[model samples]
Target: MARLPEPLTPLIQRTSIRQVGRILSNTQLSPFSMEMRISWNAPQTLPVPGQFFTILPCRYPLTLLRRPFAYSAVTESWFAFIYDIVGPATRDMAKLKAEDDADWIGPLGRGFPLPSPDVKPILVAGGAGVGPVFFLSNVLAGRGSAHLVVIGAREAKRLIRLEWPSHAEVRLCAEDGGTGITGTVIDGIGQQDMADKVFYSCGPAPMMAAVHRLAAECGCPSWVSVEEMMACGVGACQGCAVAAAGNGGPQEYKRICDEGPVFASGDLIW
Candidate 1:
């Protein structure tokens, strides 16, 4: 497994073994994406930004595997998940209504490390990856941290929008010239320097790899949230493992559901 940074150890230790969240609302963000807000009836452990949950819609018996979703936002009343309707499980999730019950297990895995008070934060998101990135922006803003959010999509119609906190400045990037910068997120970055910023990103692997390259070019440190498929959204299944750079030992694999969905940019073998 890639070596998760020492700072993440404490967060990993604080995760709950399991919990339940009740669905309060499920709204469509785009044709293929839906935003779900779930509330816990009794007090339960809540996830920090970058942490995720494994949810099984009670009605979808056909899909035994729970779906993983990063917490998109959290409030006193509920926490949210924004997911793409890519398959049977998620398509059924779109039919979920307010007050519906779903089996929720989590607040699991490691989250992004807290940033130093003096450093500026740069959040990058690609497509559905915006969920956790949005949550992180809110957390940083609440901490009085100044940050920039760069969001990307395939085209203008594919973009997702949200009310960003006042402390964050939002920039948009599009692969096609229909909106925002007419290029990939990295291309939209142009010649600006990021040497003083701390970077965090979640998205398709290729997009994140590009962000890592950008971080390297400006000599900045970065953290990334990885997405993997899992049968059990816990370490027991070992189904969501990824290769990591060998650190004075043989190559290893880490479970995305447990050790992380988040890791230092330098730690990954990719």
Candidate 2:
């Protein structure tokens, strides 16, 4: 794990900023989709992937709400994220043009670990889960490990925005049968050999639960990031707790904020 920077440490709890830069999507989806990237005037690199940064509304909007999104990708020059603009916070992001800014705080929670070279990797995602998977995919590809990526959506149009690896084999699934593969992305995994692969997954609770089952069936290891309603992104407020197995096979609670947004397969309970 990388050490947290001192400057970013304080801002981890602050929200709202003077607004900074805006990023535009090169193309729109059937309805509309745009990639939004914002930069903080704060003096540092945004936190690592799997962690998130929040964008607080400035006085002009008066919505006064903050929207949190993951650290999708980063370079020395900039950090990026993908947005579908389905709601207010993202809708605000679509409105800003270049040169405006949004305050950023992160690299929060632990990121998914890559599979060791001796094992193949399988990446699965649904909806916005695509954002973080893209970040993970690029990193693994650079190191020369091949990843089989499966993305799922309700229908062809609802499929999430993604920037995929140049060398990876990509598969998409639409429940209504209109994209790369028909049915669930889970179907994509069934068609392949899981004998020597490890899995990484994210998305809806039911979806993650299902992937957890599949990984166990194949005798493969798996990890996942949980998405829960949150107030404070850190441990202080205690908003995001996951169910874990307690001492008598009874239920226990684990904080997603302090402990993880990411967890090993055995760490979670249905």
Q: Can you give the TM-score per candidate against the true fold?
A: 0.92, 0.83
Clashing pairs in 1: 1-252, 1-253
Show pairs that collide, candidate 2: 19-101, 20-100, 20-101, 20-102, 21-100, 21-101, 47-106, 47-107, 48-107
- Those runs of model 1 whose alpha carbons end farther than 4 Å from true positions after fitting are 1-9, 17-20, 41-45
* Cα distance off (Å), candidate 1, residue 227: 0.7
RMSD of each: 3.1, 5.5
lDDT tens string, model 2, 1-270?
Answer: 111111223323333233344442323443545655554444354454466655553423655545557656776556776656677666666667666645545556666765666677788888677777788788788978787988887778988756587756788888898877888868877666766787778777788888889887877787887776567766677867888856686578888866777787678887
> What is each predicted model's overall lDDT from 0 to 1?
0.82, 0.67
Sum up the clashes in candidate 1: 2
Error of 2 at 157 (Å): 0.4
Clashes of each: 2, 9
Measured by TM-score, the strongest candidate is 1
